[model samples]
Target chain A: MVEQALENAIPGDWRVNERLKEAAIYSLAAGGKRLRPIFVLAAAEAVHGDEKAASLAMPFAVAVEMVHTYSLIHDDLPAMDNDDYRRGIPTNHKVFGEATAILAGDGLLTHAFYVASEAAAIGVPAERTLAVVRDLARLAGFPGMVGGQADDMEGAQGITSIDQLEHIHLHKTSDLIAFSLRAGGHAAGATDRQLEALARFGTNVGLAFQIQDDILDITGDQDKLGKPVGSDERQGKVTYPYLIGLEQSRRRVEELTEQAISAVRSAELADSGRLEQIAMRLISRDN
Target chain B: MVEQALENAIPGDWRVNERLKEAAIYSLAAGGKRLRPIFVLAAAEAVHGDEKAASLAMPFAVAVEMVHTYSLIHDDLPAMDNDDYRRGIPTNHKVFGEATAILAGDGLLTHAFYVASEAAAIGVPAERTLAVVRDLARLAGFPGMVGGQADDMEGAQGITSIDQLEHIHLHKTSDLIAFSLRAGGHAAGATDRQLEALARFGTNVGLAFQIQDDILDITGDQDKLGKPVGSDERQGKVTYPYLIGLEQSRRRVEELTEQAISAVRSAELADSGRLEQIAMRLISRDN
Candidate 1:
């Protein structure tokens, strides 16, 4: 359902500029784990204990995925990480050329809000939809993802401590993840206390996810990861494993996952089982 | 007031990434005409005939300017127009490396929606605010500016006619300008007829503004324009004068401006006088 929602989010044949649409759709369709959108749906389901409520969360889900995908496209630019491939396919700039890729990223980022505002049309309260729009921008924007990226690039030359690594990971990864979960809860009319629980759960899960990524970079199969390992070392990026060792990183992932599950469980949600299981699965996934 | 609002629009000391903030502010401060924001305010005042209501339009005004400024930053990138200078100063990428500039542009673009959502806190109806947010994204995203830019780049090889040039100008330039006008009208609680009139007026004025830019490139003072002249020829870009002859282009500008003024008059807004004057002045401006 999430996959189909994403597919239908952007028009395949916008008459204004087919190449721009094509470039944007290409990156979006390249397919990451779709973890962010799934998180949104799961959180919504947790709040209401019904699939229909989760369905209302689909717009937020698709919107978050678009934001994530656009960030990946920009992050891979020659001036940034300069990665030539992602998810076993050529990166956007590598495929569409740098200028078009940049614009495609812009299109996706801008259109994400259009998609999110769509919730109002689907019966979500206008006030909630507006709040979601604001939060999406705040989390996906400079205060969150963009700021973290800028800090990461600036500190790339010398990030020596676990604290620095954690700070970057929180803003770079956890903010959007937390937003995804919180948006779903908000859509389902979760109370302030329940929303806070989802945020805590999301932040822990996001950190665990990053730690697992660091671990996978050291020990995972190239075929499953779809990109070469050791890229952190190649890029001189300090990661959880680099700062705390592989064993400690693995332990941290488990701890964070457990904390995430506990937060979900304590929220008194209609059913926290799915969210708790997803947290566990995240830590165990190879990619 | 516009300048002060623009200054306050971004935090001077955001702790997350000060460098990124500086990069965005640098370009924003390297002043253009500030025409878009002024159009926003003028349209709002036209609807309600009061300065207080126009003040209420300030957030929308500032948001549109941020969008305009971001587009300029990205447009001047090495992969795009590749210009080293804008407004007689180093471009954003030139001043703050390409990577930071890219991130800064992304920051500005994403934060635009956040800024627009501020209208709600200032007492704009939630439904109206949501509509504005959606319109902002649609006019600024794939269906509008980004698509226009992609089309311009693809058609750069052989844009041989006035129709093609106008098409590019409408999307690339007119859409955002129209959005600025319409957003202001929406904020002022204008009727649908009034909003449509603002759109018509803005579209005509925007086209006239672009034509005047083309004319100024050939005939205006370099000091007045603040950048090199004849860049259109240098970039092999097709402009109004390039396709229609200088005399015809000048005549077309007058026609569009007249049409814009007529639109304002036809709306029978509470005060159409200022909007009409803005359109008339647009065609006659030196830069």
Candidate 2:
């Protein structure tokens, strides 16, 4: 579904400036799970609104992904994580050179907002667009993802508690996901109560997703994951599985997954059944 | 004057969380010539608009300065430029350590747009607010400042031509100034022609400022400059002075200053006199 949405969102006029056009396509085409946009689309659909409202969410969805990608690129720099592989391919700095990769990441992240603002101006109502912009700014700003990153950088040097770990994951991962859900709901003119429920749902799912990732990093097959296993351990970084035993972490994932479903179900959204199904599928996925 | 503007712009009710407030104040209250905001105010005044109209431009002006400061912080990182001083004091990383400095830079940059958007929402019409957002987006994006940084990074490893040097300076320095001027005019509801003239004036001055900087780096007193002399040469970086010699660079500055003055004069604005005077003063500045 996201693949289709991305294809539709990217125009087919290929005769423009080749450099920019190619860069945009190359970055977008280097695919990830499209988790952010899917959450957006699902949340909008859960409110019994036109799927077309998802169109309003695309630029932000793309922007969030770009920011995420840029962070990964920088993290892989020699000054940071220094990883050589990502998604089974040479990291951006490896393929494009450190300078180009850095600029490419910067370009993508900056352009993301531009793209989002253009969409907001044309498609969403003024007030709603303003709200979307606010939500995104908060999600990407000091108290959200960047703050989380700062904490991660600092925390990596010392021991940390489960609560602190949760704080980091909430900001680093869940904030953007929550924005995705809220933005979709806003686009669909969802009620305040509905938006709150979507936020709750997104937070729970996001936590569950991170916990599952912890489990995978510790025990999952490297071949299946397409990245080194035990890297967190190697780096002395804390994770859910490390703080709470793996068994407990797995149990926590189940608990969070159930809470996520309960939040969505309790909302009594008329069209929420598919989203619930997807949430269940996500928590149970193997690879 | 800039201090008064900043004091007014920053929220006085510190009733919120103390730490976040402190962080904001500590960074913002650090001293520098608030050239960007001055440009904003001057441009609005040139259009016969009240300060209220340019309030939207304040956050943007602040954001530009934050970006400039953040760049200084990061560029001073050991892996980057490795400078020890900025604004006559130890750089952020020097005082705060590498990790905190990195986070501070990231925090400042991300928070900049948040502040700008909030200001836009409050003081400007929705359509005009969108324009401010767009102008900021373009100024900070790859084709503008970041692209210039990329060019600078690449050029550092090799020699560059006068044209390439101009392009770098245009993107690195001029774009934000141009945005400030244009955004101020935008807030004042300047006609398209007036806005164009302001942009032209800004572009010329922006380039002239770089030429002046190049000359100062070579010829200015180390005591007054507040840093080591010949730093750019030490870094093996290219500059206008490096390429054209001091005499030719001075001539270029004069030419660009003339062009800027002419652009402002050509506008024939009812309230353009102050702006013209400021431009002239900026070019003739000795420091």
Error of 2 at B242 (Å): 3.7
**Candidate 2 global CA lDDT score:** 0.71
- Superposed model 1: Cα runs more than 4 Å off: B11-14
* Docking quality band of candidate 1, CAPRI definitions: high
Considering summed lDDT, which 10 consecutive residues are worst modelled in model 2 chain B? B13-22
- Please report the candidate that would top TM-score against the real structure: 1
List, residue by residue over B73-121, the lDDT tens digit for candidate 1: 9999999989898887899999899999999999999888988998999
For candidate 1, lDDT tens digit of each residue in A138-189? 8888889999999888887788898888888888999999999999998898
Query: Candidate 1 chain B: minimum summed lDDT over ten consecutive residues — where?
Result: B9-18
Report lDDT (CA) for all predictions: 0.90, 0.71
Per-residue alpha-carbon lDDT of candidate 2 for residues B19-40, written as tens digits (9 for 90 to 100): 4334444556677777777887
**Cα misplacement distance, residue B263 of candidate 1 (Å):** 1.4
Error of 2 at B31 (Å): 2.8
